[model samples]
Target: MANTNWAGNIEYFPTDFHQPSSTEEVQDLVSRATSVKVIGTRHSFNHIGSPTEVFISSRNLSRVVSIDRIEGSVWVQAGITYGELSLVLDSEGLALKNMASLPHISVGGAIATATHGSGFQNQCLSSQALALKFVLADGSLLEVDKHADPELFQACVVHLGAIGALVEVKLALVPRFEIAQSVFLNVKFESAVNQLMEILSLGYSVSLFTQWKGDCLDQIWVKRLPSEPSPDRFLNGIGASKAQQKVHPILDVDPVNCTDQLDIPGPSFDRLPHFKFDFTPSHGEELQSEYLIPQPYAQDALRALHAHQSAFDKHLLISEIRTIAADSALMSPFCAVDAMGIHFTWKKDWHSVKAILPLVESVLSQYQPKPHWGKLWAMKPKQVAQSYPGLSEFKKTIQKYDPNKKFQNPFLKELFED
Candidate 1:
């Protein structure tokens, strides 16, 4: 098995990385491990939920357990990725409400971190779960549902793979829909930020990509329902025009791996995501960090970023700005407040990144930004606790279920420790 994560940054092949074929096997393996952490797809850029002592993976547990079309939900093993789930759900005339830009990430990992897709109305992928089933530290199963166990559900839905090894999830679904994809070139930075929400709301999903040094945004990708209007007001901007060809988010990379664009309509599964599911990501080695600020402060935050363009210009590969709707997940960064995510995909230079990240955090401090759990962050532990008011309650709740702290990791330990 690969020693490092998807980004090839964190080396995490534990002495005992168990890949159990069934939930019972997971139970037995987890019960024997003195300490453990649950990993799925290993997509996280940081070591937040990576193994601390022993590790158990749901890799072999990928299977569709059941589908409740009547209730608009489908149950599946936690190992399944959004790419895999989308193909299955779309074929059955159902679909996910939203998905992160990259679909190869496991649904379990995405939710655990409250990872989101772009949209004015759609919440993070975690909110789609109607219920989840986990194998506790003692090899016992604990199932929580949104309707029946609301408090427990809110706490565990963003579990961070700490309380237990999640084995299965029942996700809420929507009727299958199509999205027409388009990209606008060189949108003015002034107009973009001045009317940020307006442009973002132009589509069911919208994303602005840039390198932070230019007067114009590199590109504005929009995924809209076919019946929606084109972004005419945006095109009216000086030097802005709709992309004549499909383009990659990174200015110099190949577009062959990206989804179909140029206003072509395709399955929501295909168009909603930036990359094609089948392509082995040649994204090359990269590191990521994100900050989620409350909606009211987003414009000011962007202007702050604009002031510090020099901080990122040399090492930054690209940055994606997007908006996510608020969700009820207790530990979610966007919990109960609509937020704008400012994500930076930096070149693999931890020496530079490690030094510069604190500076970036300092700039966004006024906004009280909440960093993504799976990405790089430099916020103080006390600040993290303050950002998520329920984090202390969350730690207590999970500790009640995982008394021995078998699933604890150093990343989580630092934040929650007294």
Candidate 2:
């Protein structure tokens, strides 16, 4: 049995692994399996796709069914990877407005959890989904869009594998453009936060990566409109001698493969999405926990985390802060709130992460944080309901699509059940 995902952290030996070549095949599998779950690239950190009796994958179903330049949309099989889509869209002068940290992740997998990137101006990837075609548990095909079954469209946008088997997705596209990124290092933490807001207001996207050691803020990556030359003029003025000078030679080195350098000049797809660098390779196995608190609470959350730096640094490789414009997708962590995401990449200590999660949750609870669907979370159903304003409406829609709970896993069962 092939394992799932890059992390290879979550795996199971399924009774059967079925790769469906067509929509009919998917329907048939769903109809026949006593218990089944769909898998897409297996990028999810959780076991949402785990099933004992049967596991279905859409990897072989990948195909660009249609592209409408006039409508600025593309219809593609759900299994296509963001890396593949980036190349396709590059050729046509079109691209997705935003994407997560990795291009290897499947589009379906990303949309399932409302995967997003660091961009105050950009919405979660799910918000770009115009329509979805799913194979229900009963072997019936259902098409949902804004105009047809709007509630289902919203719910299925971030279904967490509890709705149905996704077949095809219709995504809105943007005119492809170029972005220039410059990294700043050694900025003060408080000053960096202020600069982050400024960069976000002026740029298309901005990200803050820190080691949580309380020494320095480390690096800031800012992507702005291609037209803006001297985008960092003010930043340069403040630290003119250092502004023009690149900090670490290590900054240019790609953290992952360590061979490729981080430089891109042409399309947004190549420039934005995931950083070409992977910073933590030998940091050992790691557990991730991210919470989306309203943008207003960003400083408060950062302060709380900083206060616990001694404890946090004991097991953390880094903690990243990113922002996303509010979205309407039902299960999205930042649903309907302009959110600031605080993510912790803890040193492969699952026990440590498990131990500290409740404390972390309590600290952010004042801001009404919503947990990322695919990551480790400590919130109960009541807390989840309180976090998402449209919870009742979303649950009602799920009932219409998967009333019998055939799509549920142990995790989801606990969340959706009383």
Q: Candidate 2 — which pairs collide?
A: 256-278, 285-348
1-418: candidate 1 lDDT, tens digit per residue: 6777888888885878778879999899888988898888888988876786787777788888899988999999999989999999988988998989988888888888998999999899999999999999999999999999898899889988877889999999999999999888887788888888888898999999999877778888889999998875656654568878878998778899899998889899999899999987633489999999999998999999888888777989999999999988889998899999999999999889989999899899899799988898777866786678788779888789888888887777777777
Instruction: Give the range of the ten consecutive residues with the poorest summed lDDT in model 1.
Output: 231-240
Candidate 1: clashing pairs of residues = none
Show model 2 residue runs off by greater than 4 Å: 237-264, 276-284
Q: Candidate 1: where are CA atoms >4 Å away?
A: 237-239
- Predicted model with the maximum lDDT: 1
lDDT value for model 1: 0.87
- Per-residue accuracy of model 2 over 1-418 as CA lDDT, tens digit each: 4665445667667888899889999999998877778888776666667776788887887888899999999999999887788789889888888877666677888888888888877888888899998898899998888657776677778878778899999999988887766655667776666565674565677777787766567666666666765445655543412224433322443344321213234567655654442332322266777898889888878877777777657777667788999977777877778998888777776778778888888877787688877777776756675557677777787788788777877767767665
- What lDDT score is found at residue 399 in candidate 1? 83
